[model samples]
Target chain A: MKTTTVFTIGRQFGSGGRSVGRRLAEKLEIPFYDRELIALAAKESGLSETLFENADEKATSSLFYSMVMGTYPLGGGAIAGRSEMPLNDQLFLIQSKTIHALAEKGSCVIVGRCADYVLRDLPNVLNIFIHARMPERIKRAIENYGEDEKKAESVCIKKDKQRANFYNYYSDRKWDQSETYDLTLDSGVLGLEGSVDLIIAYDEMFRKTEGKKRMVST
Target chain B: MKTTTVFTIGRQFGSGGRSVGRRLAEKLEIPFYDRELIALAAKESGLSETLFENADEKATSSLFYSMVMGTYPLGGGAIAGRSEMPLNDQLFLIQSKTIHALAEKGSCVIVGRCADYVLRDLPNVLNIFIHARMPERIKRAIENYGEDEKKAESVCIKKDKQRANFYNYYSDRKWDQSETYDLTLDSGVLGLEGSVDLIIAYDEMFRKTEGKKRMVST
Candidate 1:
């Protein structure tokens, strides 16, 4: 059965979250959004793609600092009343709007960009956090991403910190905390394919439960 | 195939964790231990069952305070070198030993008492954390456990804090954190039966992956 559920994935770096999202979208025959969000946000906001890419997963204070120091440009956007906002804030707003629009359109998988928080009001959104052991994440960074072996562990740590700060700053909930999501999966233990399978199982169960709830309410 | 996998559950009060553990154990046809551990520890250590039940989930400092105030007794046990230890510590040690012994015997579902941390050295242990939202938990507390309607929420919160403190004080890892457990389930979202089904799915997947790893190693 085709589900109208939207899956929002928050993941640690090198935890195969992006890959899982992509594969899940494929299996579910739904659209997948990850880096594609940046381009979509850029298109919607009339901002440069490079600006959104650089602003991605960056905490607001750093952008504010750069804006204060006159090192960053307040890019022109088509949207009104957002010109004076920090670039990070502007990007986040546009991205959140884009995420809402995407979810409203249909069932899809969106990774990162605080889509969970953005679509918090939607009943069909399933927020998921994917994580792995530090050593396994570091190994994935080095082996899969082809990072310098010496810097892989640090890189993973840095990326996760950035994501955490970004998510925590934008959303009321803390990133990677199980309470913040509908489900949290350990990609390290489940493996990427296993994680996807588990998610599929959960999605089916979620749909069935939701169906029952709706039936009772009606 | 009859697989040997010990399931250790950490849970919030009123989250149906004990029920899930009992049902999972029955389905797996393995032994289930919750309050039963108190009796076992009492039997093994020659300490009164009341001591074990009272000392259960109480942090060490409170027991230490009682000892310093000359209110608590230093119960004699069959084990040596534990007479001088705080009652909480003694109970913890004895309970942990009981957990290790239970795990060594075969596959079993052990609930609470920091079994995940106690059996950290075991390869076939699956650490799970079960939780539910406050409203559902409070409802369950009042309806199932017959907690006072006005006091159910506070009771759930208080019990969870005690469990968290007991776990955090003894284990290197923090309780209720997703990373601490192999799987974390929201009974609030999954429902009790759904949670059990999901866990069964995960256990099967876990065993298959472990079997593959063993084959590769050999």
Candidate 2:
């Protein structure tokens, strides 16, 4: 069987990044996992959805992550209760496992959750980042949430910052830095459909390039 | 007679900012000046156009600007052969005079060269900064110049840096900072016509708000 390809999308909030990803997945006949990942991870871990949802796309908590990493058992032997494991760590473990499971299952488009880092070593993976200008983001936020202009603008900045911090903490990369991704699209310029088209076109090119490499290697 | 409102645009090169401004001016039945600002400034100063053009939108080299006001002179005496003024100083003077002249003359859209800072104190002036995401800017540069993709990408970064430096050196605010303008829109998101529509809407709001203020005062 041909190896399935997974696409991970990192995006600025309100940039229609999710919409683009959804359309791309539909057009390419791949599964699209977004908030659904949290549910699946929760089910897999037998944990409440909120625990996974709260820690979704976020790195291990800074207050305790360093402490745990420093003192926790490098091998097995857990000391005690669930609280000792740290909420973020449990969430991360479940999410990491779920990502591997999903990739093993089939090709999919994963939005956020630092999936790019979780599956970085995978051969048939493509990572993409999406961003738009402040005005464009604000406009989209207003349209999406019926927010007042000022509130919409604030939400746009806050969401992007959260996403950036999440990506940066988990990955060996500066989120939105543009260098690490297989492709980065400004959804503001292309809009949702256009962005989807661009990604599809890029995927075709990438596959062709990979095929050429395989032929050379063999 | 009513004072004419001029829309001054500051832009990164290869962003199609100039095209947006020119098209906007045409739609509004107003003059749009980019390169023409240099010629006009040169005509006004009786100096060679190259002097003004070379110094365009760069930091002012004069000691006064470097040490103090952080702006070029609007209307002033140029001491001939004064050890050759610094590049920044020449740029400052040219930008200042060019901005003031355009404002004093009538309604016009002056593209780039710090027209925003030069006419900040003036009434009925609209200043806009145009920007796009790295990918979009790179695409535009590649399409417009028929250059290699990598080369176009580098040019986009270089031009944005130049504009950012130029704007920062002269203005207290960041170049693309939304607070500096009455309205900020991403031309790439709104597209050319949408951008023009946004500006017109803002202009209408400005007049209505000003009218209300006048009524309240009386």
Q: Kindly list the per-residue Cα lDDT of model 1 for residues B1-218, writing each as its tens digit.
A: 33688999988898888899988998889999999999998998787899888789887896475663464545334446655566788779888989999999998999999998898777788888887767778879999999999999999989989999999999878888777777788786668888888888888888776532211110
For candidate 2, lDDT tens digit of each residue in B1-218? 23467787766666567888888888889888888878877887676777776666666545644543433443353545532455456556755876786688888888877787777666566666665545666777888878788698778777777777878887766775443443344444345565565565545444433311111110
List the pairs of residues colliding in candidate 2: B9-B112, B59-B88, B60-B88, B60-B89, B61-B88, B61-B89, B62-B89
**lDDT (Cα, tens digit) per residue for candidate 1, span A1-218:** 33589999999898788888999999989999999989998997777899889889887896475663464555334446765567688778888989999999999999999998888778787888887777777778998999998999889989989999999999887887666777787786668898899999998988777532211110
Instruction: List runs of model 1 lying over 4 Å from the truth.
Output: A62-72, A75-78, A211-218, B62-72, B75-78, B211-218
TM-score of 2: 0.52
- Give every prediction's interface RMSD: 6.2, 14.6
CA RMSD of each candidate after superposition: 3.7, 10.8
Q: Which candidate achieves the best lDDT against the true structure?
A: 1
What are the runs in model 2 whose C-alpha is more than 4 Å off?
Answer: A1-3, A60-85, A146-149, A211-218, B1-86, B89-218
Write out fnat for all predictions, comma-separated. 0.41, 0.00
In Å, residue B148's CA in model 1 sits off its true spot by 3.0
lDDT (10s digit) by residue, model 2, range A4-69? 678898887876788888998999898999999889988876677876676776767667677665
